[model samples]
Target: MRSDLQIQQDVQDELQWDAILKAAEIGVSVKNGIVTLSGTVDSYSKKIAAEEAVKRVKDVRAVAVDLAVVFPGTIDHKSDSSLASVALDALKWTSFVPEERIHLQVDNGNITLEGELEWQYQRDAAFNAVKNLQGVRSVINKLRIKPGPSAHIIKDNIWKALTRDANIEAKNIIVETRDRTIVLKGKVRSWSERSDVERAVWSTPGVLAVQDELTVSL
Candidate 1:
């Protein structure tokens, strides 16, 4: 296992290497295996980029983001009505999102979405549509999956999907589903592979949440 200092160094290096975020705007700290990111960014997208960069580093067990979004005064802040109008327009143009069913709520700079979609990807698509908008400070995605199939069927489908994935050692994985939540318990050779397993689970039609208890054995 890598020491906390090395892990902190790696995270700092990762922040610098990522082109989307200005490394100087964000701060990094590590304790045990957890990384905490602090500072302020002009946009919510940059905040997300910072967190993703931290996860890409090896030996990072978890991430805590203490970053705040403080846009510059030169950029005129949009009214809540303006934000909602723009968000609706963006969703209308996004092919994956069913804009007709989704509702957008904006307060100050925070965004809240509520509705039901057929797939997780569609919900994600809706979120991606507005997250990078000019005045968005934060996003609270409460979009849900419309009932399509049974939970037992979802569990079986997930098992098959896990087995079909070339990157995952399917035999070492155990999958359990309760309603829309999936509980994954297993071991994988690398962190990338473990993430792959969860990604596959998310791609499935009925998965609302994933409890990843996968250990990196390498």
Candidate 2:
């Protein structure tokens, strides 16, 4: 039997080993069963990959993920602006936008933007603008936002994405998004599909974070 601290270290080591093997390029540190991961990945999928890799290791009591989300770490105005543009495009395309109600600013790839929308859709649109873009560190969403059609629009979008995806069935799931925070509940075919639904929610505009309450049907 291992002490609590030793157990944590073992888990960290296991997680680190898996992360390295998975080529996620993360640094792992353990302190008394609390594991901290530090590194960057190109997308949210990779970020979660590192976490899931660690969870697969036995004897891990809990996890503390401090992984820095980054995309290639090359600083350039072009890259920053491109990321900003994509974020902005996501917002613009969403049904929740008041169009002229928004303004955006980017500094060395850290985005601080503002807008006004009729509902949560605008906020979700704003979130979608930056979700997986390269060179983003933090976002300060200063949208004078509201919640109405914005929320409904996101629901519609979720339904569409889930229905079209072979791994998911819309009827089995319920989605509630506010200020870009998605809460998913229902059943899915596999762990992979669960992950897929989470990813889809993250990719959508205006989502700040995701909370998945889905169970595996099989």
lDDT of 1 by residue, 34-81 (tens): 899999999999999898888788888778999999999899999999
Q: Which digits, one per residue and each the tens of the lDDT, describe model 2 over residues 11-66?
A: 55655566333443667666544457786666655565577776554444456777
Q: Which whole-number lDDT from 0 to 100 does residue 182 have in model 1?
A: 88
lDDT of 2: 0.64
Highest lDDT model number:
1
Predicted structure 1, TM vs. truth = 0.93
Model 2 weakest lDDT span, ten residues long: 15-24
Error of 2 at 195 (Å): 14
**Highest TM-score scorer:** 1
